[model samples]
Target chain A: MRKRWVIGILAALMVLLSFKKERLFTEPSGWPEAVYDFKRNPPDPAKIEIGRLLFYDPVLSRDSTISCGSCHLQYTAFAHVDHRLSHGISDRIGTRNAPALVNLAWARDFMWDGAVNHLDVQALAPIANPDEMDESIAHVVAKLQKTERYPALFYAAYGDSAIKTEYVLKSLSQFMLTFVSANSRYDRVKKGLDTFTAKEAKGYALFRTHCSSCHTEPLFTNQRYEYNGLPIDDSLQDWGRMRITRRSADSLRFKVPTLRNIEFSYPYMHDGRFKSLHQVLNHYASGIQQAPALPPSLQKGIPLSGSDKAELVAFLLTLTDREFLYNNAFSFRGR
Target chain B: MRFFLLYLLFSGVIAARCQEVNVRVTASFSGKPLLLESFYQLPGGDSIAFDGVRFYISDIALYLGDKRVYTEKDSYHLVDVSDEVTTHFRVSATQHFDKIVFHLGIDSATSTSGALGGDLDPGKGMFWTWQSGYINCKIEGRSNRCPTRHHDFSLHLGGYSGADLAIQEIALPVSPGDIVINLPLDKFLAAIDLRRQHTVMSPGPGAVALSKTLAALFEVSR
Candidate 1:
C-alpha cells in the first residue's frame, strides 16, 4: 500500500514536468547568456512558422527568383557553400560572403564589418540592396498585404489583419533566434558527460593559448572586431571598419567571427580569402601580414608547428555539432 | 487600371482640402541653389535644374472642418524631387482645416538604433556603414562652377549625440484659399548656393543650414 502511494506521487511529478514550457532559447551550461532578449518577441509556434515561410519565399526578391535561403542554404547549416561571395537574383554577385546563420541571437551586430547593429533590421539590408534582393520594405510590405494568404498568416500571429514590416521582421528574427548550436562534442566534454581524446585535449590547450583571446571558448567568439594581419585586396580595396569610423586607426578592423562550427564554415574571414582550414592555420602560423594596426596576438606569428596545426584542426572538428546541422527543424520546407 | 483611377480620385480630394487651407511656401534663394559638395553662395547664376532629389518628412497631423481628423504615426516619408512628380498630400475627414505638424528625416530614437531598412538602408548610400550613423540627408547634382567636372557632391549628413543632433520637430498652420502646399525645389533650395558651396555631402554646418532653411519655408499665410 505504501509503495503504491509513492508510485502515484512520482507519476504526478512526471505529469507536472511534462507540462512545463520548453524554453524558446536556452543558455548552454558553462556558456555566457545569449545577447538577444527573447522577451521582446517571445517564441510562439505560429510566429516561427510564419517567419520560416517568409525566409524560404522568393517573393522578397525583386525578380522573384531569390530568397534569403537562396544564399543561406539549410544543408550547409544555413550558409552559402558553393561560392564565397553571395549571388543574388539574375546571378548578380555581391561583395561579401553569406555567413552561416547559427547562434545569431548571441551576435551584437550583423555583416562582416559589423555594419548592422540590430537583429530585427538585418533582413532589410539584403532586401533593399540594389545588388541583393533589390526590393523596398514598403514595397515588400505592400506585396505581402496584397497576398491573400500572408494577411491571414500575419493575422494568425499578430492580432492585426494588416501585415506590417515590424511583425514580418520581428517574427523572422524569432525563427533565427531559435537556431542554437550548443550540443557539440566540445559542449559534452565541458559538461563532463564525455571525455576528450589525448589529441583533442592537447589541441584544446594549444587553442586556448593561441586563439582564445579573440575566438574565446564555450561560445567560441569574443564578438569584437580585430585585424589578424591580412593584406588588403587590391581590387576591392575594402577598408573593413575605417569607412564607419572615418578614423585611420579603425582601418581594416573586421569583426571577429565565431569558430563554433569552423570545421564546416570554411573559406573563412570577411572576404572568404582562404579556402581551407590548413590555409587558415598557415596564415596564423607564419603568413600574418605586418601592419601598424594588426591585433596584439598576431604581432608575432601564432608560431604553431606542423603537428600542432594538425592537432588544432582536430580539435576544431570537435566543435562541429552534427545534430544541429542535420536538425529538421531548421530545414527548408515549401509553405 | 482601377488602382490608378482611385489614386487620381484621391489626388483631387487632397488638392481640394489644401485649397480650403490656403497655405503657400515660396521658392526663394538665399545664395545659389543648394549646390552639391558645397554650401550657399551669392545668387545670380544660371538656372539650377536637378535630376534626382529625395528627402523625408514625418509626423503628419491633418485637421478637418473645425476638428482634428487624422494623424500619422511617426509619419516619416522619402520625398523624391524631380521634374515629373510634384505636390502630394493627405486629405482630412473632418470639416475644420486649421493646422499640420511634422518633422523631416528620422526621429531621434530611430536614428541612433543600428542596422535598419527602408529609408535608412546603407545600399541607398545614405547611411555610413563604418561610422555607425545615418547620413540623415543626401542632396547631390552637377555644378557648373569653378570646381571639378560634374561637381560630384553628396550630403551624407546625420548625427544623434553631442551638439550635432539632427532630429528636430516643426509645426505649421494651414492658411486660406488654394493651399497648393508646394514643397517646390525653389523653397527647399532658398538658402543654398551652387558656386561657393556647390557640394555639401556628409554632416556638418551644411546639413544644419538645410534643416533651418526647411523650417522657415513652412510659413502660415494670413
Candidate 2:
C-alpha cells in the first residue's frame, strides 16, 4: 500500500510539473485542449515577434506586392473585408474567401476543403498559390536569408543565422497560434461575470437548438465537414470536400467555420455568398436547396420567425470580441 | 569470480550483437547504369532523356527467416540518381538478416509531421507546395513521344489517404556484408502508358497507381 501511494504521488507530481511547463497558448476556462502539439513547438515571445514581422511583409510574394496581412487584417478580425472572394497579387482573384484566422490552435485542418492537415505547413498553400503570393518556399527562404533584418531576427528566435523552411513555417504558426479569441461577451456570460440581454438570451437558446450541432460552443466549430445546402456556383463548380477526398458522399461538404467574430468577418461561407447574418439566417430559414448530400438537419429548412432571426443575429453579435478585433499587438510592425 | 565471468561473457555477446552493417542502393535504366541527362530508349521505341529521378524509401526492417531481427528508427532516405551520397545506410548489425523490407515512400507520420530537414526538405524539390506532403518519387525527362511544351514528362507520385495512399512496402532478399539494392527503371517504365498519361504532377489515383508500380521495380543481389 505504501509503494502504491508513493507511485500515485509521483504520477500526480509529474502531471503538475507538465502543467507548469511553458504553454503555446493559455487554455481558456471550459475549453478543450488545443489540437496543436505545443510540446513540439513551444511558444517563445521572440519567435512570435519575428512571425509578426513576416506576416505583414509583402516580400513573401513573388513581386513583393502582397503579404499574408493583405487579406488577413487585424481590425476585420483577420479576414479580408470588402471582397466577396479574396484578391491576391496583381489583381488576381482567388476562388474562395479567406476565412478568419481566429482560434486556429484548436483547428485540426486548414482551408475550406481541409487540404492542409497541419497548421505548421498551412502557409505553404498561400505562399505558392499562383493567385495568392505566387512565390515558392525555397524562394521565400532565399529572400529572407538575403534580407538584412530577418537573419538576425531568426537568429534571436532560433539561435541561428541560417534561416531554413522549418524555422520560417514554425515561426508563422507560432504567431498564428497566439490568436486566441475567447474573451467575447458570450464567454463572459458563460463565466457568470456578465449576463446576456433578453434578445441575446433568446438567440442563444435558438442557436443551441439549431446551429450548435456543427458550430459547437467555446470554439464555435466542431471541426468537421458537412453539406450545408448551399448550391454550387455556376462558374466555379467547386465540389468542396470531394475535391480532397474524391468520394461521392463527400461532395459539396465544406468544413464548418467558427462563428466567433462573425459580425466582422463578413461575406461568409466558403464562397462568401451571404454578406450579412440576416441573409445567412434567411438562407437557413427558407433558402435551403434540396440535395442528396445535404445534412438532414438543414434539408428541411429551419423554421425561424422574424423575431427569432433578429434574436439569433443579436447573439451572434455578442461573439464579436472587440478586444481581439482591435488587439494592437497583432498589427503590422514597420520594418 | 563467477559474476565477473558472466559479465565478460555478456559483454562479448553485446559487442557481437552491435556490429555496423551497410546497405547501398543503386539506380539503373534497362539494367544499364542510370546516367542523369542521358538519353535512353523506352519500350515504346521512344528515346527519353532524363533530367531527374529522385524518390524516398523509409521504414527499413531486417528479418532473419520469419522472425524480425532489426528495425531502424527514423529511417528515411532520399535516393536521387544524381546524388550518390543519399543512397547508403549504415545500421547496427543484427544476428542475421535474410530479407530486407522497406517502404517505397515516406510513411504518413513523417509525411504529415510538418516541415522537415535534410533529404525531405521542401527546398530539395521533392515537396509539393499546394498540398503538404513529400513527393514519394519524381521522374522528370524529355521524351520524344511527349506532345507537350519542351516534350517534358514530369511525374511526381505521392498521396496519403485511403484509395490514394502512395507509399508501398517492398521486401527483398539480402545476404551478409555490404548489400546493394538495384532499382531497375525499365521495370517501372514498362508499366507506364506514357502516351495516354505522362505528366502526373499532383497526388491522385494516377500518383497512387504509379507509386505501387514503382515499388515493384527493386531487386537485391549479394
- The number of the candidate with the highest DockQ is 2
Going through the candidates in order, their DockQ values are 0.12, 0.72
Alpha-carbon TM-score of each model against the true structure: 0.73, 0.92
Give me the candidate number with maximum TM-score.
2
- Model 1 CAPRI quality: incorrect
Per-prediction TM-score, chain B alone: 0.63, 0.90
Reproduced native contacts, each prediction: 0.15, 0.72
- lDDT by residue (A107-140, candidate 2, tens digit) is 9888998988789889889988999999998999
Q: Per-residue lDDT for A1-335 in model 1, tens only?
A: 99999999999987764343246566666667677766566678788888888898888988788888898876666778757788887778888778888888788777877767677778878888877898876677778899889999889898887777778888788788878888889988888888889898889999999999999777688888788998888988889876654568888888888787777776687778888899999999988998878888899989898989989988998998988888877778666
lDDT of 2 by residue, B71-108 (tens): 88878898887877888778776587788899988778
Off by over 4 Å in 2: A1-24, B1-18
TM (chain A), candidate 1: 0.92
